[model samples]
Target: MKRIKLALIPYSAYALIFIVAPILLILLYSFQDSSGSFTLENYARFFDLSDPVYLKVLWRSIKLAVISTVICLILGYPMAYILSRLPARIRGTVSFLFILPMWMNFLLRTYSWMSLLERTGLINSLIGWFNGILPSALQLPTLDIMYTQWAVVLGNVYNFLPFMILPIYTVLIKIDKSLIEAAQDLGASRGRVFRKVIFPLSLSGVVSGISMTFMPAVTTFVISRLLGGGQNALIGDMIENQFKVVGDWGFGSAMSVILMVLILLTMNVIQRYESENSGGSVLM
Candidate 1:
């Protein structure tokens, strides 16, 4: 027992230095002004809409993150289900292939998307070729969605989708085969079996995936900076500017606190939802 407690000492010290210390400093700085005097003015700037930009950027971040999370859920669940049903011998190989892109650099993957979606890039070039082969009116127009909010959302969806998929796949593969067989034997149709038995069983995975994907999507600055162009940016961009450009640490710390609270509240709500729906079909 003494040996095990001693073994944990290094990790405990590391956490105190790296994790707890920074959070404490941020909390302290958030309540202080330039003169290092305590005040709630920085927090007031967040709530009172002293700067309209704060609320606007925050709402936009939440909206885009929600849309990206929903899209990832829609796209990932089907692929996870298909992967879960593959032959046992080949399932690991195929699942590894599904996650191959993630092994590459994240920035490189996003840059590849930039190349594919630019106005004069591959997509538009292919559209132009199709237009040349067809009549005038039949010509498809170029996609000009690059450097827009759509682009940011697309980048987020691409980057975080695997996070959504892998968790659900893990859960699905662990479901008891006998439960599924028993449901079928009891005269449940294939669709009914899925709706009642499989779907309910997988709710935990879906909730976990949503939490994992949405949190990063909401806090992403790189995707917004690269894909959203200069005029369009998220709350993360605002926070970054406050620290790096404006050099206002107090406001930045306050924004950080607000963002942290928002995420914690959302996670609590999701936990409540998971607790309520456990072992039961939401559809029923």
Candidate 2:
């Protein structure tokens, strides 16, 4: 009990000084006006859908996050499944390779895409070589994938793929081989086995992956800024602008609160669905 108390004391102090204090400050500021009078005007501004700019930015952020999450799942699931099936000796090395890029600064990784996607970028140069094989009119347009929604999605997927893979791989590794064999013995096809057994059993991992990828993707400013340009700016950019450009701490805090609430609501809905579906499963 004494050791536990001592351990918790440091954590409690850290939480108070870092998490709790900053959140409390934000909350306090969120309710105050420019004149320092307490008010809900900041939050009220968020619900004014008549301001198409805010609504559009919020929608774009949610859409981008959702699309990126889906892309991560589609790409990561198969990769994770293959990785899970590999020999234990190679799994660690493979996992390391997947995560090695994450050790680099995120800004550097994002910036690297610029060189690969520019008009005279590596991709465009390669395409130009191919275009020489055809008439100028018949040649395909030079790859201009930079500063588009695709760039933002690709950036998100590259950064968050590891988050999706790790969780799904962890869950897949623990899945019972005997259960899979039993399903096969019962005349289940490969698709059926995957859809009914493997997928259902992996809901916890899916939840973890989705939460990890989606939450960060929505709030990420650097990737969209560096890749999507200001044109594809998300709600994160809006909140950033409010604080940095408009010098409106109240509105920024309110935006932060709204984002927090939206994340909470999304997670709750997903958790409830996962719980319902895994109701009778022993795995969870």
TM-scores of the models, in the order given: 0.94, 0.92
Candidate 1: clashing pairs of residues:
none
Tell me the whole-model lDDT of each prediction, alpha carbons only.
Answer: 0.92, 0.91
Worst lDDT run of 10 residues, candidate 1, spans: 275-284
Task: Give a tens-digit lDDT track for model 2, residues 26-91.
Answer: 889999999999999987788786776777889999999999999999999999999999999999
Candidate 1 clash figure, as a count: 0
User: What lDDT does model 1 reach?
Assistant: 0.92
lDDT of model 2, residue 64: 92
Candidate 1 residue 162 C-alpha distance from true site, Å: 0.4
Which whole-number lDDT from 0 to 100 does residue 210 have in model 2? 90
Task: In angstroms, give how far residue 150 of model 1 lies from its true place.
Answer: 0.7
